[model samples]
Target: MEYVIKGYEPADALRYFEEISAIPRGSKNEQAVAQYVYDFAKDLGLEARIDTTYWNVVVKKPASPGCEDKPAVMIQGHLDMVCEKNAGTAHDFEKDPLDLYIEDGLLKARGTTLGADNGQAVAYMMALLARNDLVHPPLECVFTSMEEIGLLGALQVDTSDLHSKYMLNVDCGPEGTVFVSCAGGLLQDISKKVRWEKAGGDTVSLQVRGLLGGHSAAMIDHEMGNSIKVMGRILHGIQKQMEVHIVSLSGGSKMNAIPRESDAVITVPAGQGDKAIEIASHIAATAKAELAASDGGLYLQCEKAGATERQMSLADSRQIIEFIFLVKNGVYTMSMEMPGLVVCSSNLGVATTDDTGVQLTDFIRSSDPTIRDHLDDEIRSLAQLLDIEIAPADPMPGWKYEAESPLRQLFMKLYKEQTGKEMVAVATHGGLECGILKDKMPDLDIIAFGPTADGAHTPDESLDLASFERTWNLILATLKALAEQ
Candidate 1:
């Protein structure tokens, strides 16, 4: 394959990034990428182990001559990327290679996500491990899979053999910020059975689209519109004036991402179809005006559709609509200690309705355990009220902030000296493997930082090339400093 990145310092990093981009590594399907990392380690004669059960790889390289006695440090990142694309893109993530291109000093994929979130981290580690010139202590490079789904690989991987006192998680977003703490989260799956009845009316399809949905945990406070909730509101408003039965309802794909588009098929009284369309149009206009600043492209369209044989019963339809509108979403609570940071939040991410029932999946996040418990209770209470079954899965622990860390101070001091500016230390609402790894290794001191990447978990994702080089330099400098210690 021809190289796409040219005239860049540390060309090997970009090369490896592009190479990895060719493989299909979305969430649970990470065998090829994990094997690539394992093979690379073996080719370099490094000590490596690949856990096929969880698809995690751990590679260790001995310290340099002068730094052999220095304490070992681990660098970690996930191997999977969130597979998102534009509505009309023809790319298949399972088989097609990413069409990467350079634009205005940033790297992006054509009509799809660039997968740079953790790919760059993997590239950086690979580059460092292949080179013997860098002065650093014994290095442990760890890569886990299925992180986008719920940090499954990290949760299942065994860390008993490794002994790294300090860890650098290379899965964060912003270039100049070091994340010391992150929110713990879990997936809540709610389902309710429904009975269908024969339909006797004209059909209309209602759609809510063009909303700028984002990562539910990071952008919850941004007030971006949730399409599932918005569609429920519009349906409820139409139901107020006319009797409509739901034929089908579906929206959103991933639980971690906010729903951007939703559509529903409903049956209305043959003669009252015009009135229902009018009501839907009015609600769409109002919603557009309300979310203009955050989701400027918000649009709602209602159109005539062919009649369906069966529709949800009026009672079941009403129950589903009411439950959707009542479900809690967006920022639930703000942190008292950290101003402007969301302490607790939940996203009504994936929704679908079928003959058997309606199912809704949500990803709830909280930095405080008590707040997490409260949010769980709130969801359970709502489920009980609606007579739906709710199940929580893969609950992960949160990483608490440490006030005094010599490693953090070292990175801060090094960053100041290199850039002549201070790097910000922050607590993020997004889930990170650092929390799980810390729990597994209680004495591990960890910090997460990465190059600037915008529009993560979306089709518009891009990586800043210059920022990537600078972050690479910072990591090299930090490793060198640790060796000197």
Candidate 2:
């Protein structure tokens, strides 16, 4: 199919989107895109500023003909995207254009994320900058980097440069719903260093793979499989029935993603080793039966182990399994006011074992401050019980919903006028830039909404074609309404 840009409005949008697709703006690696924005603004004769601390780029567009005196409004979105790919897929984020292509009426990348999570919104902002027809107040377009890793960019942004009393963040995943609140989160670290000894026997390596892993925060309550938890159960079962020495264990790629696969090395006496293999197969069968409907391809494979060194002592092995089982891995509570909303949750995101000890990382989330604190207390308690060192971190706060938020009302009215249907206002289970930006501009009016996308932060992530036009209309209408006010 041939792509065309007949008008300047969408022409600018399409151009910017295509340009960045080739720039490789993965998280914390958005310097090229940031510089692109800066140079674009300067080339267009607009005053642009770059904040070195947070690496936030802003373009100040002077008010148009009749709107120069109107109150300024800021439109923001992140520039970086989470870089992830499927196993066996040959792709390099450091030097690739994402292999962009249109399929089944949706925009996506080949075997990888399209980065439309925030890229589309950034493209829209860039388009607006190139056009002079957009209505209302003086405008500022801000693009922040390192948003995927954390709210690092927003956390370090110089709010003193902000001249707007009201702000609109175009980072929500769904198309029609307006998100005004999101969950607060923190990263927890737990580690233990214990001695280990070798047990004479036949060594075997176990591999568990093919489970559909997803975002820890968004998919935690789904009861989906977790590699660390599954492998721990197997190890515990084997140790209970026979003596086994754990040589090594590893799982998970990122702290924010649930582990989908794991591998472990253990040694068992030749005679008892056959029994261990049978037990592993049985466990796999049971797990497959229980997870059949959701995780069909889950696998557990055992291969004869080559010569291996010593394994952890019984004491160390027991303590490790106990810690893994004791730590929470899913939702702890549901929202009382909002049905199906996770109020508190935890994820055992990563695990690794070595001669000294094991290191674990857990990601905790909650909309209620008290609940989050209690969960932290539980994590600390577990460390004490296991006699291991525990460390916790303080993260950004959640954006609490405001019942009478004026910005939300305006968004609703505009949404209805554009579509002739009621618009839903919701609080997301995921993170948003609103919470961090609101901290700097305490009274800043904030609302987040974006084009429709599914399987975000995963390989299946894709953007809906229809939502592109709908959301663009809603956004344009909202901008006009703000200007008229």
Candidate 3:
């Protein structure tokens, strides 16, 4: 593959960035990229292994000639990326390489995510491990898979080979702010069983589209319009004025991404399809206004559909739509400890209605354990009331900011000295693998930071080219500072 990122300061970093970007490393399909990491280390004559169960790659580069005695430091990042694209984009995540492009000094993938959320970590770590000029302690790079869905790889991977008590996590999206703590989260799949029945009516397809859906945890406070909820609201409202029976309902691709669009095919009373659509338009108008600031491009499109013999009974359809509209979603609590930080939230991420039933997926996030428990209880109660089948699950614990983190202090010191700006330590509502890794490796000191990237977990995701190289320099400087210790 030809590299579009020429002239970057560290030639190897840009080269590896372009190389890995071509591998198609969507969550759970990281085999090829994991192998690439292993082979890269093997070719360098370093210790490398891929965990058989989850395909997590771990490689060790020994300390520089003079820094052999320094403590082993692990640089960690996930190998998988959240594959998202615009609705009309023709790119396929299963096999097609990302089409990289540059605009205004920012690197982006045409109509698809750039994969820089953690891919840059891969490039940066690979460059560091491959270079002999950089001074650093023994380095362990843990490339875990399936981080985009959940921290499954980090949770399942064997870390016994790693002896590092301290780590630099390269997964944050900001440049100067170092993430010290992150919210815990629970992923749930909920279902409501149903039976189809014959309905005599005109069919119409109602689609909620053009909403700027984003990462559920990061942008929950933005109040972005969730197409699922918007469609539910339209259906719920339409039913108030006329009889409606749903044929099929579906929306969203990833359970962690707020849905940008949803489609519902339904039967309106014979000769009353026009009225139902009018009501849907009225309801959608309110939603569009409410969503103008964050998800302004919201659209509710309706069209005639071919004949369908069966549809869900109005009782089943109403229950499904009402539940979606009334579900616990968006931010629930704010942090008194950290101003402007959301402490607890949930996203109603996906919904599908088919021959068997309606299934919905949601993610609940919180930094406080008690709040997480309370929210879980609320979901359980809601599901029980509706007779919905939601399997019981445990909440993954959040990472708490430690008072004594030398790694955080080191980065802050180096960042201030290098850039003359304070590198603030912060907590986030977003979930990170650090929580799982820190929970498993109890004594592992960790801090996460990265280059400036935006619209993460969405097709609009972009990496600042200059900021990417700047952060790479910071990582190298920190490595040098640590080697001198």
Top model by lDDT, which number? 1
| Candidate 3 lDDT, 15-130, residue by residue in tens | 88889999999998999999999999999999999976798999999999999998888899999999999999999899999999999999999999999989999998899888
- For each candidate, the alpha-carbon lDDT, in order, equals 0.88, 0.80, 0.87
Residue 224, model 2: Cα distance from true site in angstroms: 1.4
- For candidate 1, write residues 1-485 as lDDT tens digits: 77777654554688889989998789988999999999999999999999988899999999989898888999999999999999999999998889899999999999999999889899999988988888999999999999988788989878888888899999986987898888888789988888888887989999898998998877899989999999988889988888878899999998989999999999988888888889998988898999988887989888988878999888888878877888889999897666788988999999998669788888889877788888888888977887777875657887877777788999989989989998999999988899899889979889999999999889899999899889989999999999998
Full candidate order by lDDT, most accurate first: 1, 3, 2
What tens digits encode model 2's per-residue C-alpha lDDT throughout 1-485? 22332344454565676678778888878888888888988999998988765568989888767878777888999999888889977989888877777678787888888888789878888887888777867888889889888878877777787778778898885877888678888788788877867556888789888889898887888777888888887877787788767788888877878899988888877777778988887887788778888766788988777867677776676777777767887888887666677877888888888657788888887766688788888888888888777775776766766677777898898888877888787777677778777767878788888889887788778888678768877777777777777
Task: Compute the lDDT of residue 160 as modeled in candidate 2.
Answer: 83
Model 2 poorest ten-residue lDDT run:
1-10
RMSD for each of the candidates: 5.0, 4.7, 5.5
Task: Give me the displacement of residue 395 in model 2, in angstroms.
Answer: 1.9
Best by TM-score: 2
